[model samples]
Target: WTIAQVKAVAQAYGESAAMLLDGLDSGEPVGALAAKMQEAVFYVGDAEYRCLADIGERAHDVSGLEFVALREGSRWKVYPVESAPGGDYFVVEQILIRPRDAPESSPVIAIVDDDPLLTAEMCSYFHSHGYIARPYNTEATFRAALGENVFDGFIVDWLLETGTAEAIIQSIRQSRHGDAPILLLTGKLVTGEANEDEVARVIQQYDVKPFEKPAR
Candidate 1:
């Protein structure tokens, strides 16, 4: 990861902690606050477990709180101390540092598109060509997978059901796989769903190669 990427992650952690603190001060339940943070994707890896514990004599669980970051097998356990106005709350943030599956000999590609048929066909095509292709029908699932797995390349449709693929592209560029090849797939240019200038800007901004739909 680049220095900027590292700093960005750190900033996110700080922001998450602040958010948690604010929520607690505002009388929000710890579990609810944690759930919100989890949904916000502050931690990078797969969240193994997240819970609230008392810092007082009620629990006194200090097993891994001393260290800033702990490596457990393929995951990293992080403890971000939060001093809520109510008291101190032990916040355990577990992020998976590596993919659960063993590294593949062939390139692993992620295809993100809302169209089930297109996603399936692309996955099948890549699989036949010796690439391990994973298909996601929505941006949410693709983002979820990003935290759990590493991909050698990405093929994302320019437009998704929820929104444009700009956020997804930006995420890939900012992630550990910053140099990974990204191919933007879209039929919108021909269909008038997206303008040429918009498409060109995204392609140049992320340095991604653009492939028109029905790529042959």
Candidate 2:
């Protein structure tokens, strides 16, 4: 198969693997989800191939076939059947899909702001642009999520309803996401609600990018 065909097959396999994992993560039974797998058709270059899903049964069939390794997301490895030795090489018997150790390709951005509207808007914008943006209306919720999920970056409002975001920012800087990008949003600077010197010191110490709101 040509390079384009190879890419097309890889894309299809990745998507399928992601959907399967999603199903399993959502409490779906493994056997029930596996049974729903259908033959994936790939139009590579000027040719077409119907690739069957092998859920442990057809392992021997793909033993001799040339396998094309495709990495899907950070957790899964997909080996799609590329070419067979005998007749009807285009129509492969099975495609092997498995898990792999890797970081997530999709960036998970944390949007921490007290304003629910702004948080929602930021999350929506990031989602529209192909990112996994999670919104938090309070520091508590954000901290709770921080313990459960690994975020790629942070967009935090400096002034929350009850307190400042300095503690939250400090926690992030000292944590595993120390090198992650952090955008500090604050309308307090313009409104004279916070000390400019303290804000600047925090920004410098934490190595955070400060943005005065309303952000465009």
Candidate 3:
């Protein structure tokens, strides 16, 4: 083939390929086109060309097509080309999107409360808010979970039957999950202590909720 004629055909094919690719810029669709092009450009010869030089000494001349293929899924897929009637159809490309797990879907919430009823209620509340709530009846269980799993936040009772609420708070404060937010729930400490100053102090010191009343 005349070098000039070969170059023109390659350029025309490249420009048309590029323009078609521009409309399909997502990486998935581009990859599909790349796979198809690789299938199309398979060769059986001893041609030495600059573009296909690296593929193998006897590979098909794919310098132009390779350039177009490389930029298939990118924003630069917008090159102009002219069409001739009855011309061959460029290879068809497709993208197949499938469902995958989200990285942030399983955020954990640890609830440190001694009452089984309270623990169940807290878990229900957190789950309602789209978090994975793991409730424990003792400081030991909470500590074990803290050691084994990562928690994004916590909901702790202000008073545990085994010890002061401070003990659980301090235990959680010292664990690897120390950075997690803690929402402390307390009975009406003196019948009416859920005031703004107390809530602010609790939120500032731990992270949200000086006290959420136990569910009725």
Tell me the tens digit of each residue's lDDT in model 2 across 1-216.
475665676687775434443543557565765576543433344564433343333333455654432323322122436532232222233452433223377799999988888889898777644578889998889888887889999999887876888899999988888899999888887678988998999989999998888887
| Tens-digit lDDT string for candidate 3 (111-210) | 8888898788768866644468888998777777777888888887766767556656766778887777777777756665435454456567765556
Candidate that scores best on TM-score: 2
What is the lDDT for 57 in model 3?
A: 27
lDDT of 1 at 192: 88
TM-score result, candidate 3: 0.44
Where does the lowest 10-residue lDDT sum fall in candidate 1? 50-59
Q: lDDT tens string, model 1, 1-216?
A: 575665676687775434443543567675665554321112323453332222222224545553133333433234443311233333443332222343367789999989899889988777645578999998889889988888999999988888789999999999888899999988878778978898899999899999987796
Q: Which pairs, if any, clash in model 2?
A: none
Question: What is the alpha-carbon RMSD of candidate 3 to the true structure?
Answer: 18.3
Candidate 2 accuracy as lDDT: 0.68
Q: Tell me the lDDT of model 1 at 110.
A: 93
Q: Quote each prediction's TM-score.
A: 0.52, 0.53, 0.44
Put the candidates in lDDT order, highest first: 2, 1, 3
Off by over 4 Å in 3: 1-104, 191-208
